[model samples]
Target: MRPYRSVLYIPAARERALEKAQTLPVDAIIFDLEDAVAADEKENARVLLARVLGEADYGGRARIVRVNGLDTPWGAEDIAAFRGAKIDALLIPKVGSAADVEAVARLIPDVPLWAMMETPAGMLNAAEIAAHPRLSGMVMGTNDLAKEIGARFRPDRLPMLTGLQLCLLAARAHRRIAIDGVYNAFKDDEGLRAECRQGRDMGFDGKTLIHPAQLAIANEEFAPSDAEVDLARRQIEAFDAARREGQGVAVVDGRIVENLHAATARQIIARAEAIAERAI
Candidate 1:
């Protein structure tokens, strides 16, 4: 799995934001042309993003462009503008079903696709959407989902739990990355940290950000902690020793360690390595 701890969203229309993004320490950057760019500025945003893709050097960070939906007048043109451009993925907004993935997949060949899981239909058909061959990731669109379901926003995201899990299950089942929704209160570091921890605990690979300030919190929360890494290493060592001794189980910190536990520990260690490598 990719280390997508912090994915920042930058309006594709903002030249300064696009340029400044090269210096930000983010795992990925979503060049948003959907809600972030005004309808009147859609064409200009597309042109600007295409130019940025050609000229800018984002350096190991994944570049994803969120285009307007095909139902909109600007959607086709948005796809057309980025043809052959160097972007890692195309994020389709308001994805309702597998057919929605296919619709965009047909137009953007050789590019991985990401779906926004926001609407009721999208959540209901998440399994099918995730099964699409070209699909690589899913981003939870909690704000739009709240509006669609008339759900009241709570810090715990009690109302959005079902949808979040549904999408996450599908993404994991299909080996695709699942990113948590953005916190609306960008300035509230405590609120953002709480939400990031919740998302990470709930099994989201990462959280999307509306502002760069949220990057540090998201990155810190999603990463494997030093204590966790140390524990994982110890668990792996104990389990390997037990296996060599023809034993099926080992004890770590007075708790039983088995093959399953060792496997999880290895994954944690590998994830930590991946994050470190990306940083360098």
Candidate 2:
């Protein structure tokens, strides 16, 4: 959850793609064992994924595995194979409630869990799913959610707004990271930029990307601007000064800056620092 400005998905079945991911600038890499892999390639993909993970040096990128659900024949093997694997978190697909999280949590109690909020049921029980002790973050499965809800894809994402906000609220309420869904038009830079801006405006921590092409845009859009970083520094300084003076609040740029705003500013600075550290 350390400022995942661009979380890229790499098909676990493709060794070349996995090798290529080592050089990408993505904040996180989802070694996909689900949708990206074919049914016939499940076992081989899991084996290859484990080998790559064991042998490769991913630098600062967060390595997360997107495993198939328990309902699938290969799901159990997928989970078992990753029991002691080197990974940041195990992403469980179609997590509808706390029980779904618990089901996988039982297998790998030590590893952090990430849930996919794609179903209507998952949306309704988002708070419960997010409250799980092992749960670290939630990823919006917009494509699956749209298909399940039979909603058409809109450029403005008017249809998915409620679901997106609900998931974000639940994640924030529980102190967990919430990532926005992918922009389907990976080649449409303008559309991707607009969507990344919208996601940032709506309070998403970062975005789940399908292609490497989307990384730069997501990283740029989600990062705080120069003006914002400067304001955050000023707010923190002013707030500290007001506190020393026995004042309850401080004024910054003609607005009342309270401890709450200062707290948010600190987080922004910390996020910026985390991003910088990853780059180094």
Predicted model with the maximum lDDT: 1
* lDDT at 79, model 2: 95
List ranges where model 1 is wrong by over 4 Å. none
Q: What is the C-alpha lDDT of each candidate?
A: 0.94, 0.93
Deviation of model 2 at 116, angstroms: 0.8
lDDT tens digits, residue span 211-249, model 1:
998999999999999999999999999999999999999
Residue 127, model 2: Cα distance from true site in angstroms: 0.7
Clashes of each: 0, 0
Model 1: ten consecutive residues of lowest lDDT: 76-85
The prediction achieving the highest TM-score against the true structure is 1
Residue 88 miss distance in model 2 (angstroms): 0.6
